[model samples]
Target: MRTAIRLALPLVAAAAALSLTACGDEDASSDGGSGETAADEGGTDADTDAESQDSGQDGEGGSGDGAEAGTDGSAAPSVDDLMGNWFVDPADPGRSHRIVVEGPDEVSFIESLEAEGDLCNRGVYADGTLTFAPEDCLQQGAEPWPDRSATLVLNEDGTLHVTWESGLEEDYTFSESEWGTVA
Candidate 1:
């Protein structure tokens, strides 16, 4: 469907980072996305290719903050702008729902709930919205996640606005850059 195609990258990397770490919540949803929750190692190359093409920005594009710097309300933030960590209200950030965006088309929408932990979903960035399909979402090693979808928008204050397929809306504040913690 249109929703599936609109989704792109992120979950692939996030799953590797959060597969075992509990985020402190719970989702009752079960596996239903695409009904084909199988891992396809064959698709790795294609994902890499797409990420390289979408991330054309170098080290000098923005203010160096993980969040987008420009205040363009009419324009959607680029994939580079979305790359990093976002989380719901939490003092330590490790105890809430999180979104980790790694590239132009890859987005990992992670929940605090154990049942619906890290969902690596494909995302399409268009018209200021990144639409994602979680049905086909996977963990790092192709671990399957429940079927779902969500719409994401970056706010002027550098927060993330997400509306789940279940009609739940939540705002996540920009955390730190994923790169910062790698070392």
Candidate 2:
């Protein structure tokens, strides 16, 4: 049962991404893999799913150690807070990527490189961090995009940072699309 849920999460995330394609400026196209990409159109403040509505509410206490901690003494960047479209920081855009996080368990990451590709992963969120399943579980054209590493952190300033098992790190700020901004 656990394995089934794990596999289904990415599939569900992919379906949710389909609804988001219309939000992009570029029409959706196949990448010959499970990954998908769309043109940049910006994000809206709209809510795409019920889960988004409650993402801001922290279920647990905040450590107040990071910038994401609530000034009011509450927690910030709750699990749901990481949902939405996150873009590469314009000031330092490299290998442009737009990551759409859907519920607490699924994410669709669209990266625009010389060879554009995207990947969907089933993961979990806790302590202001999001980690996806291993690459073996998510394949793109016979290979996983990053077969070893998948981790993300949400900074207090509403910026996002991602680290791959390959030791690559990236800083990202939220992108706005007609659909909505990255939560």
Candidate 3:
């Protein structure tokens, strides 16, 4: 009976130690609950999904940047600002003309010079030099028009000096009153 009690005592101690270890593990797991772990992961994923959705919406709405609408979205060139659709001499009906300046690269003039109607063409202005060319002028059967280039210099005193080389290399100074905005 003494030997059995000795063995029984050690068994009981071993059981107690096992129980303590199991309890400690349970407490650690409870301190940092599984529910809290799951919630943290779910919240992170939800935030990422929301950000991706917002980015996708922006791509659909033209990138959500106004720069694509204009050069810088600050100010855009207008017909009035560029001297569009103006009569050379409004007081004299016979000398009236129409000018359509499109953007910074194209200029079309409809003067009252001939019945074939003033030509419509494209031109470029750079470094105070303007060059005008008729549409498809280099193509076959195109009219053999004279030098269709012109140079325009804007004076500081609100006047424009226009020089054309169509057998009439003449310089004309136009006042602000002779030009009007189109729109």
Candidate 4:
């Protein structure tokens, strides 16, 4: 019995360590999911409220060249230009559900499993980064939810590359048959 306990003790410790590591990975940062911190998640709803106030400022509508003027006044691509409804091909695993991008600042996706309700709150990219937090507590059940954040880069060839810290990354290219303006 003494030898059995000795071996079990190490096994128990190893199991505990692994569990802790998994939990840590799940809640580490926005890189884990929407790339938001605890403080950002807490204030995301407020940020949404604040964004409403600035929606009017985004009225300067034009085709997004994905380029902007840097602080040095040099021409650089801005993620803001990519803000618009992006119809993600449902058939593609790399590309999930269709996404309605309000701007680089906000994004919304209709619930894929269930289409009977409002859009499930997700994340958005501003300054070329996307961050999402759980906004609707009622809609999201008691699952371990994490914030997600990622940077968006639009290539001149019309491909979108998303790099996230959560080890989840994808690259999407527009399909001519499925590409069009969102109505």
Give the runs in model 2 whose Cα sits over 4 Å from its true position: 1-76, 89-95, 113-116, 134-144, 178-183
lDDT tens readout by residue for model 4, 109-146: 43222211123344555655666665521122112223
Which candidate number has the best lDDT? Answer: 1
Q: For candidate 3, lDDT tens digit of each residue in 1-183?
A: 554344334334433443344443434433532322211334223222222211111111111222112222222222233433333333332333334454456655444332212334465644444566655222111113344565553323222334456423222222223232222
TM-score of each model, in listed order: 0.48, 0.45, 0.38, 0.40
Candidate 1 or 3, higher TM-score? Answer: 1
- lDDT (Cα atoms) of all candidates against the true structure: 0.46, 0.44, 0.35, 0.37
True-structure lDDT of candidate 1: 0.46
Two-way TM-score contest, 2 vs 4, winner: 2
Candidate 3 least-lDDT 10 residues: 53-62
Q: Ranking under TM-score, best-scoring first?
A: 1, 2, 4, 3
Instruction: Give stretches of model 3 more than 4 Å off.
Output: 1-81, 113-116, 136-145, 167-183
- Scanning candidate 2 in windows of ten residues, the lowest lDDT window is 43-52
Clashes of each: 18, 8, 0, 13
- Give me the candidate number with maximum TM-score: 1
